[model samples]
Target: MRIDAAIDAFVRQLTVDRGLSEQTARAYRGDLVDLAAFAEEAGVTEAEAIDLELLRDWQWHVSDRLAKSSLARRTAAVRGFTAWLARTGAAAGDAGARLRAPKSDKHLPRVLDRSQLDVLFARLEGRAAGDDPVAIRDLAIVELLYASAIRVSELVGLELGDVDRTRLMVRVLGKGGKERVVPFGVPAARALDRYLGAGRPALLRDGIDALLLDTLFLGARGAPLTARTVYQLVASLLADLPGSGPAGPHTFRHTAATHLLDGGADLRAVQELLGHASLATTQIYTHVSAERLKAAYATAHPRA
Candidate 1:
């Protein structure tokens, strides 16, 4: 069998039997695709034919140029692939058993300050109130993203029936098909109300009740907004703002979570709101909150 086809089957097994997240499965497939391409060029076809020296050399070639995190993730893919080969009796032993990922740099997430958020929100409101339905839809998209701290996929996948405005909560289908209810503040609710009432109707070319119809923010053709479009919106907003960091839809989530913690929201509460399966995932915002507090104290307090 071709290595690409074999790697595809292996990744499918990881998804169905091992219950890995789709993102993880996709990453594994990407790493293995690169490996398969290289092996095919070198005339190595079978998993058993992959020796430690070849594995080491491939990793060395990749590590020399790729970022440490990228190299680390690719290394993990190698280890996982080799382990799978051994488990399935395709190989005598794990060829990459001793392979190591490079240490990754722990860069803090970029966050917009409260004032910046205020400015962005103001701009969003103005845009939404304009004579365009797309702008109105974009208002709701921005509001929900910042308000919920959900992944972009989750946000775009949202349907009208999924939101329970009566309870001020949204039912989200998170990673692993896990369902969770995430709450947002009143402001988000208002923006959503505006979109549903006024904006969405203007964009309806078909009978769809999706809360964010066609896409929350539609293009000139009146189709739903793509994740890339949402990312560009966030990036554009960050560019207008003063501080510099990795700006994307995710940055809004990090900022929202950190700000909630800074305002003394309980850690567990933040965890649930973010739909994190582990408290550890939510705890990163706690560190962000603490860092902000330290910075504030250093600037404001003179008691040193």
Candidate 2:
């Protein structure tokens, strides 16, 4: 099979069989497409014609251009693609088996302090109280994100029926298409109710069609909300905050988990709520908690 054809097959398997998120599959496809383009430039387009040298050369070609994290991801993508090609008999061997990726920098995710969150939510609720449709939706969006600690993907993927208001819980379709019921607080439930009853209807009045049908969150035009829109919303929300890290939806995820830990929620329970496949990933929040405690102690101790 041609390298491009093999790439498509691998991505299809990733999407259909592996059940990876479309965003993740798209990233892998993009990385593999870069590799295939490099292979064609090297006069070897067939999967069977791939070699370790071609893989190494491609990595080196982009090493100077992309960030270490991006380069590492590209390397992993090629490694997985070549291994799949070998397993499927499209390639004689795993050409990228020995490919090494640059080490990605590890940074603890930024979390919001309790005061910051209190002020933020207070402002949002005040605005939402005024009957602003977008403000209501924005408050609901942040409320659900922080309350459930679900990914923004899961947030935007929600349907009107997914929310179980009586239970104060929501059914989130997480990564790998896994479904889990995550509980939210009364505050979030109230914000959500206000949005659904008043905000959503107002947006629908502007326009409504099948494309806008059933989606829980609506864009400015009543279409299903996009991830990019959520990103921009969160970015603007955190624009003036003090701290460093991604000003994106995941910050709310981190903050929620950390706050839960601070409030004495069980570790495993948080793991289930976040839909993390590994406890090790959940343990990172413990580290964040410990760090916060140390900072508090250092500031308060008289001897220090």
Candidate 3:
């Protein structure tokens, strides 16, 4: 089979059978497409022609151009593709079974301190106090993001029915199509109430369709909110802050999880709250909490 055709089949199986998210499947496809181009350059366009040597050569060619984490992801992508091809009888053997990439460097995710969070919320609240619908919506977006610790994709994917205002709970469809309920604080509930009651109505255009009406958050043009817009909203909000890492919505997620741990929330409970598939994925916050504690001890300790 052709490498491109094999990659398409593999991605389809990933999404349809394995239940991977569209974003993940797209990443797999992109990595495989790059591999296919490389294979073509080496006169090995057929899936059956792939070999360990060819895979290693391709990795060497791209090693200097890509970051370690991206290289790791590409290696995993190709390994999955080759394994699938072998299992489906499209290839002679799994060419990437022995392929390896360097482990990605682990940097603790950027987390905001309580004072920083307070300043951020105060700014948002000041803007929301005015009658501007977009400002109100922005306030609600940041509030719910920090309160619920949801992925930006999950946040924007929410529908109107997904939230239970009375209970202060939200139902989110997480990675691998898993659905979980997450609770938010009263502050988030109040912000959501304001957005739903006033902000959303003002943003909705006349003669809107039913699908958009069901969407929980709307853009300035009354369309469903997108992940890019959410990122921009968060980036602009965090630009003037004193921190030194990414200023996207995931920073809110990391901050929320770290704060939860710092306040003595159970590890397993936080895992479920964040809709993590594994407890190991949630343990990173514990490291963040410990680092914060060490920092506090170093600054306040009087003894040498």
lDDT of each candidate versus the true structure: 0.81, 0.92, 0.94
Better of 1 and 3 by TM-score: 3
- Choose the strongest candidate by lDDT: 3
**Candidate 3 lDDT, 167-236, residue by residue in tens:** 9999999998999999999999999999999999999999889768999999999999999999999999
Error of 2 at 241 (Å): 0.9
Q: Estimate the TM-score of every prediction.
A: 0.90, 0.96, 0.98
Residue-wise C-alpha lDDT for candidate 1, range 103-207, written one tens digit per residue: 998777788898998999898888777768778778788888988888887887677778889998988878777788888879989988887888777777675
Best by TM-score: 3
lDDT of 2 by residue, 1-304 (tens): 9888888899999999999998999999999889888889899989999999888899999999999999998998899998999999998888888989979987789999988898888878888888789999999999999999999999999999999999999999998999999999998999999999999988774446776578999987788899999999889888887889889999999999999999999999999999999999999999999999999999999986
Worst-scoring 10-residue span by lDDT in model 2: 203-212
Candidate 1 Cα RMSD after full superposition onto the native fold (Å): 2.7
Model 1 gets an lDDT of: 0.81
